[model samples]
Target: MMYFAPYIDASGLHIPSYTDVRDQLLSDARSIFGQDIYLESDSQDYQWISVVANIVYDSFLTSQAVYNARGPSTAIGSALDIIVKINGIKRLPAAYSTCYVTLTGSVGTIITGGVVADINGYEWTLTTPISIGSSGQATALATCKSPGPITANVGEINKITTPTFGWTAVTNPGTAVTGAYAETDAQLRSRQAISTAQSSQTVLEGVKGAIAAVSGVQRSVVYENDKNVTDANGLPPHSISAVVEGGSDDAIAQAIYNKKGLGCYTNGNVPVQITDLYGVAAVIRFSRPAYVDIDVTINLKQLSGYTTQTTTDIKSAIVAFINSLTIGDSLTLSSLWGAALSANSVPNKPTFSITGVTAARHGQPLGTIDIAIAYNEVTRGNVANIVVNVS
Candidate 1:
């Protein structure tokens, strides 16, 4: 039922729409047999023509999909090797988070693996054995029940439910880091389509493009700390820094490994280290994005006629514009106002004021919201975030 272009190219030789094909066939039948054919009525001849036209129209659509490179042939993205070869980049699977699970027991007591803990009803299982020493406690690496960005929060998992022999208590020592979801079909298609234009060559932009193809990655920026350039972040000469967000440590590391040049230093606060195909070690790091929240107040003097849906649509348009911003982007009042008035079916234009603009770090517990955000922040807004007053 989805609508597609009814023509294949500028010549419009292909008839992709059933309605258009049916109408044309009906017209042609009338011209061939005169008024006796009665093609527009519900005659047996008309029924047969309709069925045949439907089948032909479907064929046109399928042929169009194949010619447009959007057919089922491209859906074989499940094969990782095929995806890498076709898209010129490897798609990463879901990523897991590693954290220390604490266990309390008598001195010298051995805390066994598979001991479970409840973090707000989510389970975390220990993998390595931990021996209680002078501290009468132990910590071992544990993995989340499932992987994804949901486990990336700090201090979100506090409660421990599973009891272990000779252990008094159990809890996760810190927030789970570097969990991520699997790649989706739409996401894969988008990555593949974009890479098709550049061929995924081994260039700076190509490396960044490859990283962007990784699942759970929101945005990435690649930088080269070249010679004669005094690096502010204290990188070795001729090093590369791959700053990324919303990605697991393992996935991001592999993405960098697949694309980075040999002998280049991988810089940043890498949660984990990854070795490239040639056994070259590189530290892949993540830079979390800050979220900026904008509070908009609009006063509309209804001129002529405007529907209530128009007001609702205006709010959605404004919020959509705000959310479209990416990392290292800034927000301005003028841009926000323009977005509000750009909504379709909105019948009125009114003056507005941005009463407040505030931003905060994603996980900052106690921080003031500033009126403006820095370049490394992304904006978040919704219909609920905008207030409209109509008279």
Candidate 2:
């Protein structure tokens, strides 16, 4: 009675439920044997025939399911692992954001490699030893030791701890961005299908596709200066610029090396040079995405419907909404307001404001409190930093 399979319809173009398979077999048996032999009596022979029909119907349903499962768009694609294996694409893994941090201490102080620092208990480790001089500086860039996107916030982790000697302060000048989880099945399928379709030759889009397929790469944009005109950015003519988020520079560079046209150039601030199997070097230039902290404040009046857990739920909703935004994506004030208002415990028309928009810059938060975001930047919001008030 519980059917979970589809069969071809009479039209041949449509697939419909196989719910009547058992009944159809029963009907055929009745028509051929006549009801006088089976339907006229509640006989054991009739029961056996019915049982056999049910078993045959179940087999047909299983066959239908087996047929449907072969398609990538169906639910069984992931279950069977056919989506990746068939297309030669694998799921990207999660990655952490890396950035530079400025460490400050006494004028004569020194900080060594392996020294650990933290913000919100998230650790950033110094990759090299640094000494403080007249400037009271030790190191300028610190890499994140954490392995997830949770430490991707810029300008948030400033406190220095577990220093070598006399190290006083720590700060990140640039936003620590580009942490992301592995691509989902939907995302992988989109990239896999496109790449597979273009398998014959490597093109510009193919280069982008290959980069996107790299594990931990969340998003990417490719720009070309094919005319050889040096644009305002001083990029040489025939150069390509890739702006990407969430992946290792080496992996991205290798992907570019595999797919880009020969003699085409790559340009950017940081360059990763990779050698191919033939020992040819390819240099790919790119910049990691910058993170902008979105600080929101909600004002609400406690009503009969309000519960103690409402604030927590609202904060969670805000964090979830912020996390949903991707690189080069902009969020309007209205959308953010709606996200806060959509919380289960928040009443209608809850008073709110975009208290501020801070660009997690190296030295300070740049820009006014505007809702607009730059193309190379993404947004982040922390529940602990969110301000929620209920009167």
C-alpha lDDT of residue 4 in model 2: 33
Segments in model 1 whose C-alpha atoms lie over 4 Å from true places: 1-15, 28-53, 70-83, 86-88, 105-121, 128-136, 161-168, 185-203, 206-219, 224-240, 244-360, 363-391
| Model 1: number of backbone collisions | 0
Across 1-391, the per-residue lDDT of candidate 1 in tens digits comes to 3334455468534544787777777777888888676665468888998898889888886675455443323544444335455555556567666677666778887766554544335566676567777898777777867654334234544554555566676666565554545655555555565455334554566667766776667555676777866476555577777767665678877766666776666666665677757887656654556556566666666555566877887777777677656555666666755676675453354333334332233324322233355434566664545677777
Could you give me the TM-score of model 1 versus the true structure? 0.53
Over 65-180, each residue of candidate 2 has an lDDT whose tens digit, in order, gives: 67666666653545535656676666666666667777777887756664445556677767666777788775556666665455545476676657466777777776665455
Go through the candidates in order and give each one's C-alpha lDDT: 0.61, 0.64
Which runs of model 2 end up more than 4 angstroms from their true locations? 1-82, 94-148, 152-178, 181-186, 189-202, 225-238, 276-282, 299-305, 345-370
